[model samples]
Target chain A: MSVMASTPSAPVKPKSNTRLRNTLTFWAFVGPLALGLLVFVYIPIVWGFIISFFEARQTVTPSQFVGLTNYVDMLTDPNFVKALVTFLIFAVFIVPTTFFLSLALALLVNNTTKGTSFFRTVFFLPTACSYVVASMTWRMSIFNGLPFGFANIVLGWLGVAPIQWINKPDPPYFWIVLVTVRLWLQLGFYMILFLAGLQEIDRALYEAALVDGAKRGWQTFRHITFPLLRNTSVSILLLSLIAAFQAFDEFYNVLSTGVGSSSNITLARPPLVYIYQVAMADQNYGRGAAGAFILVAIIIAVTIVQGRLFGLGRAEA
Target chain B: MTVNTQTDTGRRVIDRSERIAIVLNYALLIFLSIIFLIPFYVILRNAFLPSKLITAFDWTWLPMPPSTNGWRDLLANTNANIVDGLRNSLVIAILQTVGQIAICSFAGYGLARIPFKYSNIVFYAILVTLMIPGAVTFVPLFVLVASFGWISTFQGLIIPGLFSGFNTFLFRNFFLNFPKELEEAGLMDGLDHFGVFFRLVLPNSMSVMMSLGVITFIGAWNSFLWPLVIGQRSETWTVQIVLSTFMTAQTVNLPAIFMGAAVSILPLVIVFLFMQRYIVEGVKMSGIKG
Candidate 1:
């Protein structure tokens, strides 16, 4: 190929020149993005790691190094610990719930022969909605702590007393608001993923199963469909786990009193929200940076564990 | 003859069961669809209703004597500066999408096609960045932006978001599968690698580019945390930030808030409706390839 591309006259000199030119072209293509990744991503992360070791109060660049004191302080703080616990409970609740619901939706949508697109569209529409807007809608209108609110209205029809969904966190009905809103916003996106996975399964497999006396609904699914969907399910589980850890916008918009007002509702504050307060609101950059690292460690650890458990890169049967 | 009758009955039984299953499937789909759509219906209805009716003890399915009070209040509220927020969001999302596509695609093509000595090293470096979650770098990135004096500026909002390792990875995957014969033909016509990429590869890869562009645009429009950190000033706020203020502001105007939410969602809804195919395809690709 190189011989054909070189000049007919003075082939040796032209070949070397072409090689040099190819190397330059490669740099021209990849240099800008590599530079960007270094400047924006790599530098900030390294800087944050350094800052986590110091007492960075009201400033990012601190003079005094505190040698893991910031980490110790964050670990010992009840609020920080509580945030971690909150994230744990949230991940426990949301990851499986989203996984199952989205898979169920994909199954339901995929089974239907008519109006499949309509159902998919209706479900996926919420994925386009921002968490801020969805949180507002959930907090103000649907799950608002008033008799006229949507949830209360439904409760009234069911002969249950009007419950203050968010304000009074006792009995912890606030989880209802949080869980349902997140479910509504995310279910469709994951369903689409599962749907794609479902489509890739050979139609002949199901036919073979049926001929082997497998029933259509659960029996076939349990034997064939579910096993085939393992890869999709695992990836979805991982993605949802990450998303649940990053649950700040809804927690902030729904629970906090107002802009810049300290939140009195402290039940479900995730690590990101807590870190945001520590770093942005309280101006304790050291503690906040330390907290951020802890969250990252948890995410990375969970992802690795999940990947190992699933045998992620192993070839499919 | 008796055995034949038995088989016929069994077949009929199976058909009946299948029909019942089909009915149940449609029933569940419709039920779930309504549940999915209820929030949109509620938001739209509430946005057009007066505040009193929104909180009234008696609820109406439809907003009666519909008033534009919410929309009017939202527009007149000077502190929110929602119009400015919308404009800024549009500018930021558009610029970021264009820049990301150009830069990431170029890198992706080179990494996939070019035989550079250090390609593997560069590829692994990019791959490793994907593991570092955004939370780990949020504070320091903010500090970096601040040091550059980019706070409350378009540069802060647009530039940091332009280079996604994941996007570059996607482009590389796409280019790897691109037909080599086409590129060789271009080479035969006396074009260099850059010329072939610009004239042949890019044009042929429009579907992937379009799908990725739509996904990036929607993501940029809907992003919250970074814009909140950087665009502190009202003049630089994205629509998401503006809608957030309506909920968290000192005076919580319920109607105006609903109206703002409705308005903020409009652009994305339009984009989704128009590019629904590409958006879904892009998501499907991410799931399959990631």
Candidate 2:
């Protein structure tokens, strides 16, 4: 330790041997982590892709070569097509709503005066709670059908008919529940993101805008805040889309069971939940694996298109 | 309506704008806060209602009068060992948090500081894993854990969760914002990369570590699906898992269920309330990317 410490102040001499030893030591430290990641995450993912090609059914004499069989079924499966459409509809609803809501909240919280943290905490507190618990609470207290839930009671106060948000005939209503629950939960996380973006802006810009007799309304936002936050907007948009695409837990608990089968709410289930059913409930492992890969492909494709459209990835590169 | 107008500038009429902006800001914030808080209000209000009085409508609106019935029922026969669920949950949450913090920081340090070969490849590998959904890996993971003789034990629950690619990515992402000269200085001072990383880097990155620590601990505490598979025994069930069992009942004691749900969400909410300023600061500080 003393010898190594003395190297900074004392006469420095090149020691090729020590450098080589340090490099070796670094590799040694990294070896276990790399191998673990390979075997656990990477290998399984590779195996998943390979497994997609075969009919890996346990009931028969194990998995065998059924080349293009999985993809063939996947291509023709009506439910898969339906789920894709439904999920597209979900993303369209969720992404924009989350985008604006978080932006609006960030604007609101950016004031950061006394007790602003309280509102921020209250808003973000739900993110810490799980989907299952929130869903259950929503089911019990708020969305209760007739006069049972909070939404109905509020509607009742306004002399309106109770619209079953979850159990309505339109599957999209259920999508709304899923989407809103998702938005409500994730607002604070993104708000934090936006707040971070806000802090990076040069205060001089706001001052300069103020100097030009800018009003409280459009000028402050247009000249000062909006231009500064373009990059953060792209990120929020991408992350929101990804989260909507991967929407699982809320949908799982809110809408009971699978679509085209027996959904207590509506005939709409997202890809991951549908895949979960195909894999776990029906034990259709091969089909389920194929569906998962299909979803992954769609997510990657959509994310790429979005990244290009927003110019986010190009800027990063 | 207070404004900072000590300077004389005909061009910049800022005092009126600042006052108007302050009022508009508070009004807008208060309005947004109402919108943001409605769901939480709904959950909190309805949980205390008597189950029978609850219609599928308006069941959980304003508490007419506070009622303890729901809570009493939810915790009824909580377990043979009363605190076992809470105990197990705490243990798992703490262990997972501590373990993940250690592993992620070390890996993050290695990635950020150690000038090794193929470092970018290693970092990208971590990032790519985030896209692979848990549904894809659950089966193989289940098989792997089962094979390792780790099922239904605390070790099985805690060990697999300790290595998080996302957390590592977050730390390493924030680590770049730090001036490398301090680490370089430490390197010159007799400190190896590991020593510098341990002593100098971590000490400076307390906020990032603290924020991630809270998030990680809460996540571990609320984990259900993984615990469901691994926690085979009744005693092994987390509080959330135990509460979920009530859903399977044909006649759900609503009060009890709500009570349990409320109980589960409380500690997290409390933690957020107390540590939130630091938490938000930490998250913002950590959001800096290369």
Candidate 3:
């Protein structure tokens, strides 16, 4: 209530009087954040790069400087190659599925007239649910390979035998468990993004299209809605790509049964999981750091190439 | 006459199709809602059912005579340390949220309102960090924290994440659009810039603060990998790390697992239900700016 600017007093301060104080205040405000970024982000990233050139495993200090050996080792390692290939497969599977599904969901919710808020909340509830919980739910209750598990229970209804979703890595149907959990967790978040984009479209454009012979919803969407939603769609795709590459939680937790099972590593380990194993589990921080940089390179290259292809940040066509 | 009769039939056909469409729409929505809700239902039911009866899936959809065995077991299990995990997570999340709000908003206000020569450079430097994926810095950050002997300490878990670049950017953008008149009035009354920020600017920032606070709190609470690595000791483990321990252990207690999962996410679900509008609004805000 006291936030009004209508008080009667001097409107403008003498500029020179407060300049020095202003400068000091400015630094006081911005200093902490800059210091945080430097210590946590900038310095650590540089250290990560420097450590990748040496053999700094199992110890805090780096004494041996085998330039490019760590990088070369990771590049040639079968496990690293396997991890990259696995992530690529995952990205390929998840990116489009999530994009299309979220868009479809956004369209559905947008079309609804009543209980719109109710449906939106229900769909968005999973976004609040942690991936750890979701992964556990999927692993034990849904796809546990038991006769009475949720997926198997449904399979029984069709007179089919229960499938070992996580254990059968030969054909790799575990992708179902991985992909579905991510889809359920992320779809509603992206749906909200699409809804925001949809809300921004001019109603007049739709009315005009309908009046000028666009009698079907599909036609109107094709000519106007889809094109206008391009920016949101591109951003969603880019974010999904980044997230897919960073896929670790569900993959690590769901596939591994916690004891003496080396199957999870060879099953579908992503770059982060691979790096975690190499660094923490094996005590090879040098190689782990190198693997991290390599993964970062791939992510950067993909992002730049995708941005160019999509003309992301460019004015609308 | 023929054209008029044709129009009449066409309109009736459209009405009948519209009726069918509405029915089909509700059916599809209801079907998907059930699909979305089943996992939650299963977890909730299993959390209340006795551990022995958990695997006996005779449509255990609703817990019969709902027992508290799972909750009792989880709280009593010393190795699990679910309560301690929850406490640590709360400390980290709350302190980190407070720190972020203070640090980011101050910098945001400085960048947006203060007429400084190097502000743009500072802003862009922070922005550039966003492009670098967190994977690039993960190992070295852990190394640095370890060197400081901060492993299993609150400083290690909380300090590095105190300020978010994206959040600082959000605050800057929000402050830029903020009404300058309020601050100008404060200045007219002999209040300095800092005074104005404290008295007027911050009070008016309730909505943005709430949005960022909730989002950041949820993120900090649900974070797994970082806490798993940093808080290796059972004493310092966050709720996520503790729950994940169940996944990695030799013995799997189904009821305890469900209950732990349920309890881990309970705070977020409560916050979301009560402030659903703000959360949705927050998503929209991020989408527009992002």
Candidate of highest lDDT: 1
Clashing pairs in model 1, backbone N/Cα/C closer than 3 A:
A259-B248
Judging by TM-score against the true structure, name the best candidate: 1
For all candidates in order, the CA lDDT equals 0.87, 0.71, 0.85
Q: Per-residue lDDT tens digits of candidate 3, residues B10-95?
A: 88998898788777877778788899988889889889988767676455667879988888888887777899988998999999
lDDT (Cα) of model 1: 0.87
Candidate 1 segments whose C-alpha is farther than 4 A from its true place: A1-12, A259-262, A312-317, B288-290
Better of 1 and 3 by TM-score: 1
Q: Ranking under TM-score, best-scoring first?
A: 1, 3, 2
The DockQ values of the predictions, listed in order, are 0.74, 0.38, 0.63
Candidate 2: DockQ?
0.38
Q: Write the candidate numbers in order of decreasing lDDT.
A: 1, 3, 2
Between prediction 1 and prediction 2, the one with superior DockQ is: 1
CA deviation > 4 Å runs, candidate 2: A1-20, A58-62, A257-261, A312-317, B1-25, B56-65, B77-85, B130-156, B173-194, B223-236, B285-290
Judge candidate 2 at residue B283 and give its lDDT: 60
Chain B TM-score of candidate number 1: 0.97
Tens digits of per-residue lDDT, candidate 1, B111-215, equal 998878889999999998888777556887887787788999999999999898888999999999999999999999999999999999999999899899989
Can you write out model 2's per-residue Cα lDDT over A146-190, one digit (the tens) per residue?
Answer: 565667677878898776777776544566567767877888888
Error of 1 at B61 (Å): 1.1
Displacement of residue B81 (Cα, Å) in model 3 is: 0.9
